[model samples]
Target chain A: MEWIRFFITAALLIMGMISFISAVIGVYRFGFVMNRMHAAGIGDTLGLLCVVSAMAVASGLNMDTLKLLFLIFFMWFTSPVSTHFLSQVEYYTNRERARFMTFRKGGEPRES
Target chain B: MNIDQAYHLLFMGALIIFAVLIGIMLIRAVIGPRITDRILSINMIGTMTICSIAILSGLLHEGYLTDVALIYAMLSFVAVLILAVMYIPAKSTRGQKQSRPEMADTAKEKKLQQSQSGETTRQKARKKGKKA
Candidate 1:
């Protein structure tokens, strides 16, 4: 039983690491900050979820596991909000945004 | 090997990989051309740090580290939020006209130059493709 649990935790941990690896690669390769945000989201949501769950599994059913679950919940809620703020900053600050992004309302590209 | 040894090896390997990933993100943060890119890279670094701390808590069998990881997550979130907020006021203060009209005019000139350069590049690529 101990061996089984160990293998399970190892597997989950490996999967989480793989997710983090890909997220880092995507962030490096993507052209724009907005595109990179998509990659970062993968690590924030899936990578953290897997790793924390593995920790919870390793620790077993305890108060720590409950805390880990809450950590995951909190991250899921906050990642999008932070990403939104970052993109808003990008949208307002980048002068070349008109080249990369399409405008919805004006039908013509306008520079700020 | 036994279960304990196996667990030790696994956690050790994971920690090493996390360290490498964090280092790569540090480079990204440093070389990032734009402020948003730098902030995004910093945000990613914070996340990986949280994961590493959580893994450390498990490997060292420290319960308090779990709480530390939780607190770090909250702090990281707030840091990114605050950094973003810091950049927002300059754009919002002028009611859409932009606070620095001169900068916008220069940006427009640069955009026109970039578009012209882009068109030339596209034409060159088309000619090269057609030749083949």
Candidate 2:
């Protein structure tokens, strides 16, 4: 039973690491700022969810686990709300210029 | 160290990585060209910080970290909302009006006006073509 618990915890930690790495890659690789926000949402909510859940399990059922659970709940509620507001601001601000790669609008590349 | 000790070390290492990510985000916040970009980075950093706090609480077996994480989350939400409200007309009205003096003497504005007029003409022609 102890070995089983250890294996479960290890698996959860590994999963969390993978999620975190992918989020970092997404931030670096995505074309535009708004798109990067999209990537960030993925990382913050989903990636962090897996990582925190794994950490919670590893810690077992203690007050620490309760705290971890609360953190997870807070993230789940806030990440999307924050991301939405940020994207809305980005769109309205006209700061959508792609610094890394140029993306076309509607099917035609913008000639600027 | 034993395997049990190794797990604690690994957890600490993860927290360190999370902190580095937040630092990179801070650089982005500082250098962002637009107000929205700054706000976005700031919000992201806040979220990452909360996560780090949770991880630390777990690692250290301290319950205080949880309360810190909760406060951080609430503050970040409020901060982002305030910034969003400020961002709207602050850029459009103040930014544009302030830049108009520089824009008046610039070729860029002239070219923009010409292109806009050209677009209007194109729209009229397309309407005419459709009617015919």
Error at B130, model 2, angstroms: 20
Rate residue B30 of model 2 by lDDT. 80
Query: Which number leads on lDDT?
Result: 1
Best by TM-score: 1
lDDT for each residue of candidate 1 in B45-88, tens digit (9 for 90 to 100): 98889888888888999999999999999999999999998887
Q: Report the CAPRI category for model 1.
A: acceptable
Question: Which candidate's DockQ is highest?
Answer: 1
**Residue clash pairs of candidate 2:** none
Considering only chain B, report the TM-score of model 1: 0.70
DockQ of each: 0.40, 0.36
Error of 1 at A11 (Å): 1.2
lDDT of 2 by residue, B21-119 (tens): 878877777877667667877776776777677677767877787788878888988988887866544333543335322211224433444554444
For candidate 1, the iRMS in Å is 6.2
lDDT of 2 by residue, A1-112 (tens): 6556666766776676666666666766765677778777777787667777876776788786787778788778877877777765554445323333333322113111
**Model 1 / residue B34 / CA error / Å:** 0.1
What is candidate 1's CA lDDT for residue B41? Answer: 89
lDDT of 1 at A54: 95
